[model samples]
Structures are given as structure tokens and as C-alpha cells.
Target: MKLSLNSFVVVALFAQFASARDTQIPLEWDKKVTWTEKYGPQSDQPFSGLLSFSHLPYTRCLENEATKFDIAVLGMPFDTGVSYRPGARFGPFAIRSGSRRQRATNGYTMSWGNSPFNQGVKILDCGDVPISPFDNALAVDQIEVAYSTLLDRPSAEGMGERDITRLISKDGIEHPRIVTLGGDHTIVWPILRSLHKVYGPISVIHFDAHLDTWEPKTRYPGQTTDQSRVTHGTFFYLAKEEGLISNQSIHAGIRCKLEGLADIENDESVGFQLVTADDIDDLGIPEIVRRIRQRVGDTPVYLSLDIDVIDPGLAPATGTPEPGGWTTRELKRILRGLVGLNFVGADIVEVAPAYDSADITGIAAADFVHDFLSLFLAEKPPSVGPPAYREEL
Candidate 1:
């Protein structure tokens, strides 16, 4: 039986519409988000009840309670530590606001091979840590104090018999990863300090343009001691000297030393396996992952991503924008490469939301955060409960 061309055309149109609806539909996996109306009274508003930011209740851990999050996403808005760019303190909120709008999509392309789907990853935005408006010195102190509470050891201060039992039983068990949004690149120092206190000797995957190894104690003249104390430009030197991280496991991305390669090679205390922008072009991203994995293996890795690692053409909202940086596609590929690694903590830093047009930098930064979380979640057990972000549903 020959079907008419008009009948065939009608059938094709129906199928196309159905496919579009399916693609646009939000995934129903996030079962914890409870959305509500804000501002107006319950009667006057379109919806009742105030919106709760937390997706999960406080059933375990003291650190979780103080931040009002099972997994807190705090922002460190400190850029006074930077030598080049000054207005990165506003990075955290912009990144969060931009990421809050993206739904699940197959962001992976065929060039990266068959990348697996992200499983149940529970991430929450815990908001930004307070900073001093007038004083740069006070801002660093404030961030340290705020982060210290989150990194505090478990306590017997307010625990019942049941709570004590749970604590003892779950001792040595790592829970609720912290995804910190940054004000400046230096904000990662306190976070790494916290993570090192709990999960010691973490391997750092430093993605940036500069080596950031300048210290007051170094031979470089005119570098002051006060400047080396807790600034954004010199965290690597501090981390090495203070023994927060091992130099052997540090991998730097998109580097260019104007003074020559002597600085990086001479520093025995900070041995960076360099992945220059040209290295990405010559060897490709798969090789980039292979090298990163070789050095850091399956250890508890901390990913410190600077948005300035992207070209100014792509990401203009950073303090110091490099000329040849990773493309969005390449950056995503690198992230997908680290999916199975044991990542305890991570941060997406140096996104100055105020500098971009239509918040494009914020959008890119947020998307990177989303991709990182996706990779992190891909490692979780398959049978666990759904993700904790269901407000979109």
C-alpha cells in the first residue's frame, strides 16, 4: 500500500515536534529542591512558602550545619592579593547565577570519544563569605575565619547518644565535597589549607597562565615580605613552604615565562609538569589528560581552575587575560578526562563578572563549574539516591 506524500509529511512533522519536546524537557533526577515565592505575602504572592536554599537536611556533620548546607558552595571575593587585575571579588555570585540556569545536556562532542553520562552529583551554592569594603588586610582575615569553621573537626559540644554513634561509625568517611567559588585566585589557598588539614598531601592541578611562584624570601629583588604573606599572586610558594601540597604532583596549564624558563626549572621546591598552550595544540587534549593522570594518578586531587586560562576573546572578565589560552571545547575535554579521579575539593576562580558583556564570562565560568561537578558525580555509586537539585522540575 503506497502512502500519500501529504500523509508522510504529516507523520514527519509530528515526530519532529515530539523530539523537540523531549529534548527541552528537564530531567527528573533532582528530587530535593523545594522552590517557593519570595517578597510578597502568601495570599498576595503567586506561590506560598519561602524558598529554602538547602536541598538536604542536617542529619550528620557539624561543619554542614554552620554553612547551612550538606555541601556548601561558599565564595571568597578577595582580589587585593592580585598584582595585575583588581576586581575579581565579585566572581563567586556571578558564576553561581550563571550556572543556576543550565539544564542537563550532552555537552560532550564526538572529538572527545564516548564520554559517559554524569550520575547523581549533589552540589549547593552556600553563598559568598563576607569581605571588608575598605580594607584589603581585613578581608583576608575574614575569609580565613569563615573557612576555618567549615574545616573544624567534629565536636561533642551538642551531640546526643545517636549523634555520637553516627560520628564514630562514619569516622574516616569523606562526605559532602565543597565546591568553592572564588573572588580571586588567592582564595584557593585557605580552601586548600582546609582540605589538607582533613585530607592531607593533596595533588594540585593548577590551570593558569603564570607560574605564580614569586615569594618575598626568593632572590627576586623588590619583592616585599608583607606582599608574600597571603596575596593571590603567591599562593603556590606559600603552599610549598607551609607544606600544604607536594611539588611533585602539581600540573600547570597554558604558561608563558617572559623572563625565560629559568625560574620554573630552578625551583626545586615547586616542580610543575608544564602543559603550555602550544603543548595542547601539538599533543591534543587526550595526551594532556594522559600526562596529568600520570603525575597525579588516582590520589585525592584538588582542581584550581582560573577562568583567565581561557583567551580574553572567550573570557574577558578576568584580571590578567592571556593571549593563547584553552578554548571552551578543550577545557571541557580536559574536565571530562578527570572524571574517574578521586577529587576531594575544587574551585573555579578569577571570574570578574563586572567586566563582561551580558554576563558571558559568568556563563562560561558557571558552565565550567557544572562540567566539573558532572565529572565528580560520574564517579559516585550507581544505586545511590537521585541528585539534590529538583527545583527546576
Candidate 2:
């Protein structure tokens, strides 16, 4: 208490040292520290391992001992069928790159109350189909063959099985579902062919700005049939001719101007009811869901989402973007409402990233795929073990 100035200085120095020694430092001072190798290997780098969809493991469907997966994502990089834009050939890459955003979390959706990646489903990116760039006919045939090859792969045993009451197919075989990242809407034709071979003519829930059911028209006036004219606009027409779709199919978010009134008649003739973009305000999301469920009740459905179905302000990097369409929020809500529908396959197409602004369209496309996967996983039976997120995280 009666210390001198020099004594006070010495006491303060000793107190400071004591405090510093008492504090527990985070680093191990006795251990050898190497600055260059402090973090070990960088496994999460973009260039490492397989660049498959959403950075998932890459597996081949045609391999000798292929890993059985519940869902397979195959990229169809063929875009010759586009009538307006050509760069949708790069859509699958853009979508996969943008999907890195979802990897930070557990890939969970609050809207669905579950993570698609955590529901005992084994998913793999099976890579892109080998497509012909020069010959459209040959390209179509190649896509059909590639899709069929993947569809024929056996599903993972006892993984992500649906409820017994929901298994309506008489064959007792639970085929693996596909989530195709698109080249264009034309890819749906070959997909329809493949799905038909497995589960006969399916009901479709088509979302687009255009009807995409146009008759094949010739460039010249004197032609009887345009054998070389299988554009994206005419795929559903061809599907109708081949009896690949049921009358219960429906089209939503359609707002494009048509060549004539016959286009609606033609689309209706091909077994599709129309719900234009303008109808969203009048009917609301719940009514729209009711309409869709009532139209394709208890049938196997193939969901096709064209990016142009979203407003160009939100998703401008599509092949044929129209002015009037749904916002991203509206689209997500509508997709979430389609929970119990028997969705066998789905695709999000027409994303041309060259025209995208700051990857807004790519991110939107990735979100759609995520939402589709959530819907698919949510429809499965209860998991036999703890959820993957609970155990892995």
C-alpha cells in the first residue's frame, strides 16, 4: 500500500505478465506450426474431384457395377431444337455451377420442412448425353437412347420407397426417377419416349410462356410434310400423335401470342387445359393447385418447367422469354403446393447463361431444381434410420 514509484512500476509489470499467462490461448504454442500447410488439403475447391451437378458424386449408369441411386441427374446439352436462341446448350453447366450456393447448408427447405439430400435418397450426376451437333434427327435418336439407358438402371433397394398405397403401378417395380437439366424443350420428346416404354402415356404438368404445341409447318408453301422440322415448339404435337400424353395434362403460365386461335384448339386437342399467366391473380395459388390436381388425379405426371415461364425481369436468359409471366416467389409457392402428385420425372430448361445478368437466371434455375428434388423426396415413405442431416452433420 505504501509502495514507491519504482516499486509500483515493477508490481504493474508483474500483474500484466500474470494476467497474460492466465489467459488460455487458442493456438498450441508448443506444436510445430507450418504456415503453408496449416489447413491441410482444400477439398471444397471448385476444380477438385468431379464437377457433377451440385458437386455430388459422379457415377456412370452403364458401368459394370454401377452404384444404384434413387435419383439420377443427366444433362442433355443439345440445343439445335431451339427456334430463337442457341446458347441454351450451355444451360446444364450454368445450372450446376450455380448450385454451389445450396452446398453451404444442409440443402434443406423451410417450406417443405425437410432436406431432399437428407431423406435416405442416393443421387448422382450421371453426366451429359452424347449428342450430335450436326444432324437433328440423329441427335433426337441419341437423346432417346441415352434416356432409355439411364431409365433401365436398377433403383437403390429400400431407399426412398413410396408408400404401399401410393404404389399404383401393377408391375411392382419402383423405377428410379430422373431430373434432367436441359438442352431445350425438345429433349422432353425423347424423355417422353423413354418414360412411355416404362410407364405408359403420362399426364404432363407443363409450365411455359408458349403453348409449345404448334403443328409442323414447312418453310416453303408447297410441302406436304416437314420431315426436317422438329423444333421445340412442335414436340407436344408429336407427343400427341404418338399417344404419349393423356387428356388430363395441363399448361400453366402461358402468355405468348399465337399464330391463330387454332393453337389453343390444337393444344386442347392434344389433351391440355390452359391457365394463362393472367389467371394467377384471379385464381390464386391454392385454386391453381386444385385445378392441377383435379386435372391429373392419381396419374403418373411428368413436370416440365421452361425458364421463360418466369418473367424476364427475374429470368431473362431463356430462349423465348415473353413479357408476362410468374415471379420467382409465385413459381416456388406453386411448386411447393404440388407435394403429393406422383412425379416420375422433371426438367428445368431453356436457360441461356450468356444473356443472364449476374447469374440471376442460373440461380433461379438451380432453385427450381432444388424445389423439384424436395418435392420428390417429401413424397417418399418414412426413413428407416435417423435422417442423414442428423447423423452426418
Candidate 3:
């Protein structure tokens, strides 16, 4: 067989394009911080930990513990509350596997500030909470229990009967920062319950395709189906009713549902703000960030990210795919804009791998999760100025 000159040139051009595509834009933060490879499980070093969830560490929130790490990565691995899909229960495992293949460090990369590792930030994958299939209530209960242990209250405050003084004297400390991986959006209820119990009056920044304010039961007429009758749509309402959250502080993204528009208009107590799909173009990214900041303020923010907030074409693996959702760049910009605020905790929910062929959704979900942590962790600790020097001279 003879190859023509045109064919040779076409192949050469293809090689050049592939080479360019393979290259990544070098990160700017790499110059400021010292980078090191991790040695064991969850560490950036070569190890078998990231590949399998079973080997991931589940450390106790004691003063000194075996698996003590600063930023604990927990897997909620349950989706029973979902009224639309059953596979999100497998989300945590899929995300973990994806992280291993992606080969990115689970720690903060120094883009805007110092590396989290150098700043005493630790990251540990605390494995998944045990889950029961198709049982929303049980799943929520288990998640609460798992997080309660992680929160680490003293025995006097109804924690496990461990010797407090003895534990505190050691290196490990309880009440460490927590980063959660979710099975579905309903998982937010339990996490909020736990965090609110510890950090009261916490504000929430919700990224989703709906306001998620629908009452589980409403009197609206011609209601063929009560959209909020199940766990999928009633998380916020439940949180509000239980007094676990301040309704005024909630911010939602790209909401498109008209099911509860009248309810929002008539309600006084629940002053939830919606950044509807129509507003995305008119308001723009900076304005959206301003609105979120205005609504949330300096209150300790809890970020709840539902993958469905992205357009279905970009994220088809979610249980409820809504059109006209935020683009990836927009989401990245929004998250980056949230830096320096008091972010107490966060969760990335609703990633179902069973629906996608290329694992693109999971990859996007992982990177989004990574970027959220990076931005939050890289934030500079508020400066405490030195004592007044007027007397010096």
C-alpha cells in the first residue's frame, strides 16, 4: 500500500492538535508553595487507597486518633430519598474511583494563597456511612450518627464516653472541618441538622435547578402530584420547619419550576431567594455573586451543590435534569467568588453514574468538588494586626 502526500500531511496535523490538547495550563500558585507527594492512602503518593473505598480511613473525632486528618472527606453513599432515581446511593464510590483515575491531590492547590498542607490543612477520606436501600429515613439517621461522631462533643454534652482530658492532650482534635460527598440532595437535611446543632443559624448556598422550597403537602388546586410530597423536594422545607436553618439566608441557583411561585410570593417567614434561569443572562455572574453575598453575608455558609444545577447536556447523570442551568465556567466563577467568607461546611450531591457512558458527569462532579475545596482552603485566614506601636517612638 502506498501513502499519498496529502494523507501524510493530514496525519501530521492531527498529531500536533492532539499534543496541544494534552497539555494543561500550568497553575500560577505552584511557584509560591512547596509541593510534595503523599506516601500512603489518600496521600498524593503512589498507593492503593484511592482505588477502593473499603481501605479509606474512618477516624474518630478525639484529641488523638489513628486516622487524624484536618479536612475529613466523608462519603454519604445513599440515595433512597430520591423520588426520581435509585442509583445515587453509588455516588460516593464512583466519585472516589474517579478521583483515583484523575490523579489530582485531595488537598488544596495554592492558586490564590498558600497550600493547605503547608498551612496545617489535613485531608482524610473517612469512608462511607452504612446505607439501607430504598429507605430514606434510615439513610438520614445513619448520616446523622456518622457525622455526630465526627463532630466530637464531650461526654458531658452527650458524646461517646471517652476520657476528654486524655484525648485533648494528644495531637488529634475533635470538631475538625468536614467535606462531605453525597448520594442525593436529601442527604443535606441530616448534615444541616448536625451542623446547625453545632454551628447555629447557619446560612445555606444551594446550587440546584429548583428553589427546593415546595412544601411536602400544599393546598394548591389541580395538583395531580404534590411535588414536595417526597424527600427529593422537601429538604429545605423540612429544615425550615425543624428550625435547623434560617429561611432568610438560603440562596438557590437557576430555579425554573413554576410549581410553587405563588407560595414564594405569599410566604413571609421563608424569605428564600431564587436566581432563576431567566435571570442568569440579565443579571450576569458578578451580579449573581453580589446577590449571594448580600443574602448570605458573613454568616457561616454551608454549600449544597446538586449536579442537576448544570444543564442536562453537561450533566445527564442526575435524577432530575433541568434545562438552562449554569455552565461549568459560571459555577467555577461563582465558587471562586465565595472566597474569604465564613464557609462552615459543604456537600456535593446527586451524582448517579449508572446513567452516563463516559463518566463525564462524575468527572465534572469531582473537579467541581475539588475546586470548591481549593477555593475555600486557599482563602487567607483573617489578619489579626499587631499591637499598636505608637509608644515605640
Best model number under lDDT: 2
**Model 3 clash pairs?**
38-45, 63-172, 71-122
Number of backbone-clashing residue pairs for each candidate, in the order shown: 0, 0, 3
lDDT of 2 by residue, 213-264 (tens): 8777622233335444577888998898999888899999999987678778
The digit string of per-residue lDDT tens for model 3 on 1-393 reads 999999999999999887776575344444563343322333533335535322334443432344455456788888767767768877886677656543333343333333333444455566677767756566678788778667553221211221122233232333555677888888888887887766676678888886666666563234435333447667777778778777556555656656455767623355477776666789776677668878877666788889888887888888878887777767876676666556767888888989865877877887676665564554332122111111110
| Top-TM-score structure, candidate number | 2
Give the TM-score of each candidate. Answer: 0.71, 0.84, 0.72
In order, the Cα lDDT scores of the candidates are 0.62, 0.80, 0.64
**Where does the lowest 10-residue lDDT sum fall in candidate 1?**
384-393
RMSD of each: 11.5, 7.7, 11.1
Q: Cα lDDT of model 3 overall?
A: 0.64
Ranking by TM-score: 2, 3, 1
Tens digits of per-residue lDDT for model 1, 122-227 = 3345556777756666776676666656545233232222121123222463345666788887776667677676667677888887666655445345656564
Clash pairs (backbone) in predicted model 1: none
Better of 1 and 2 by lDDT: 2
lDDT of 3 at 235: 76
